[model samples]
Target: MASMDVSLKEMMAIDGAVGAVVVDYNSGMALGSLGGSKDLDLQIAAAGNTEVVKAKLRTMESLGLKDTIEDILITLNTQYHIIRPLTGRSGKGLFLYLALDRARGNLALARHNMRIIEEKLEV
Candidate 1:
């Protein structure tokens, strides 16, 4: 299993990755983070995205959907934001967030790689 630092570093290795973080949705805190520019603050982003995750989870419950979220994607004109909730016992209430440059990133491959990282992450 990969350590949190190792997992976050792996995330930044993805093509176009500008920033990455492992956040605890329950507390809106980042356990580990890597790569962020002046334009992108990983701490603030982590806290703000906690609300996004919580909202989707509530919406799913309200809709009576007995399902789990594979990932959440937010696309901007210049970037793609991917939020992946971790399902492993040690990773409950946590998620991995990645920011990618739209022009340089491959969405399909990023998602696949994130899944693999999530699986190997040891929290």
Candidate 2:
């Protein structure tokens, strides 16, 4: 298993990664972060994405769907934002957030890597 810091560092190694963070959705707080800049404040992104996750969960409940979310992807002109909620017992309220430069990123590989990272993360 990998520590949070190591996992986050691995996330940054992805091609085109601009930032990565491990966030606690229940409190909208980031437990760890790497590679963010003035243009991309990971703390602010964590808070905003917490709302996104909450809303999706609520929507799923309201619709009576018993499915779990694999990941949430938001595409912009210049970037791709990926939110992956951790499913392990120790990681119940946490998620991994990754921002990538659109032109340089490989979405398929990034998603694949995120899944692997999630599986190995120690929380």
Candidate 3:
């Protein structure tokens, strides 16, 4: 298991990582962040993604789906944005957001690594 800082640092080690953050879905704020270029403002991305999380949760509720979101993926022309909600009881309402360069990232490996990171993250 890893603490927030450790987890964030580890996430940054992923191949093609452009940025990563732990965000509060309810408040749309970043609890921690790392590796953002000038063009990628992680805080703003976190806030915008808060809506995406909320919308999906709302939709799931409306549809009466018992399933929860494992993760959310947004594929852009040049980037891959991944949103993974924290699952621990203490981690409710928080998520991990990662941005990667599609050409340089291995989507499968990144997703698998993110899952491990999420499991080990200490809220």
Give TM per candidate: 0.99, 0.99, 0.98
Cα deviation of 106 in candidate 2 (Å)?
Answer: 0.3
State the lDDT of candidate 2 residue by residue for 1-123, as single tens digits. 999999999999999999999999999999999999899999999999999999999999999999999999999999999999999999999999999999999999999999999999997
Q: Report the C-alpha lDDT of model 1 over 1-123, residue by residue, as the tens digit.
A: 999999999999999999999999999999999999999999999999999999999999999999999999999999999999999999999999999999999999999999999999996
Model 1 segments more than 4 A misplaced: none
Candidate 1 similarity to native, TM-score: 0.99
Lowest lDDT 10-residue stretch of candidate 2: 34-43
Instruction: Report how far off residue 101 is in candidate 3 (Å).
Output: 0.5
Candidate 2 root-mean-square deviation in Å: 0.5
Runs in model 2 lying further than 4 Å from the true structure = none
User: Highest lDDT: which candidate?
Assistant: 1
RMSD of each: 0.5, 0.5, 0.6
Local lDDT at 44 for model 3: 97
Those runs of model 3 whose alpha carbons end farther than 4 Å from true positions after fitting are: none
For candidate 3, list the clashing residue pairs, or say none.
none
